[model samples]
Target: MTADDQRTAADLLDAVGPAFGKLRRTALLEVDNPISAKDLSRTLVLNLVLEHSSHSEVTVGMIAELLGSDPSVASRMVSDTIKAGYLTRAASQQDGRRTILQLSDSGRDLMTRFRKHQRDAYDYITADWSEHDRLELARLLVRYVDSVAALKERSRTKEGDQ
Candidate 1:
């Protein structure tokens, strides 16, 4: 990489850690407006189910794998989310022995409101930025997250091939 490219990457790496913590704190506090989420794990579990349901079943194993968490920890988080009435676990139809996750109605409602709060927060935070810049940042952020997931998946596939 060029000197400038290397510097840019270094700057990004420096900013990422704090940025993620700030995002979690902001979501927990400000985003609690319409409907408060119990915790970050609750939000994450619901989101994972929502995102993965179209393509595949969501299980505690999937949650643990994707979150890079221990299976027991993922199970506890899922159990807590279920206790809060935001998620439900059921026997998988294709594999009755496997438990799959689905969002409850309350979960769907909370997510809808949660998204609105996120958009509001984004607009408010970026009030000084140009509309084009704000939209570009949103797009780039999603692209970045997808790239990270793709890389992790590639690593997992390589490990499994060994």
Candidate 2:
């Protein structure tokens, strides 16, 4: 990126920082119980599970891997979700000892509502942008995420080697 582009990017980041902070605060305010002050992270995890996993069984390990979290953390989240009436666990048909998880009806309903809110929020934020701008933003965001993932993998490899 040119110096002008870098400056513009920095300005954009600076402008959006407060917007995200406010959004995070607003989301927490919406929740009845602020469990561990991790509302945003939990919501993201729930979204991942709902989006990637079919109504079919999904393993705790898969969720953990996808979220780049420890298995115990994912297990705890699953347990909490189950307790909250959002998820159900059953014995895996493939492995009797292994548990498989699926979202309860309540979970699906909750996700649908959250997704609608998310879309509306996103749309409002980008309302002024043209379709081409929206598509370019989407493409760039994907590339940025991919690059960050690669950097994370490299860091993990370095840590493992040491």
Q: Evaluated with TM-score, which candidate comes out highest? A: 1
Candidate 2 clashing pairs, residues 3+ apart or interchain:
none
Which regions of candidate 1 are displaced past 4 Å?
A: 1-13, 31-40
TM-score of 2: 0.60
Clashes of 1: 0
Give all TM-scores, in the order shown: 0.83, 0.60
Candidate 2 stretches with Cα past 4 Å from truth are 1-40, 55-57, 142-162
* lDDT, residue 56, candidate 2: 49
- Looking at candidate 2, what is the lDDT of residue 127? 74
**Clash count per candidate:** 0, 0
Expressed as tens digits, the lDDT of each residue in 106-149 for candidate 1 is: 88987887777777788777889888989899999999999988
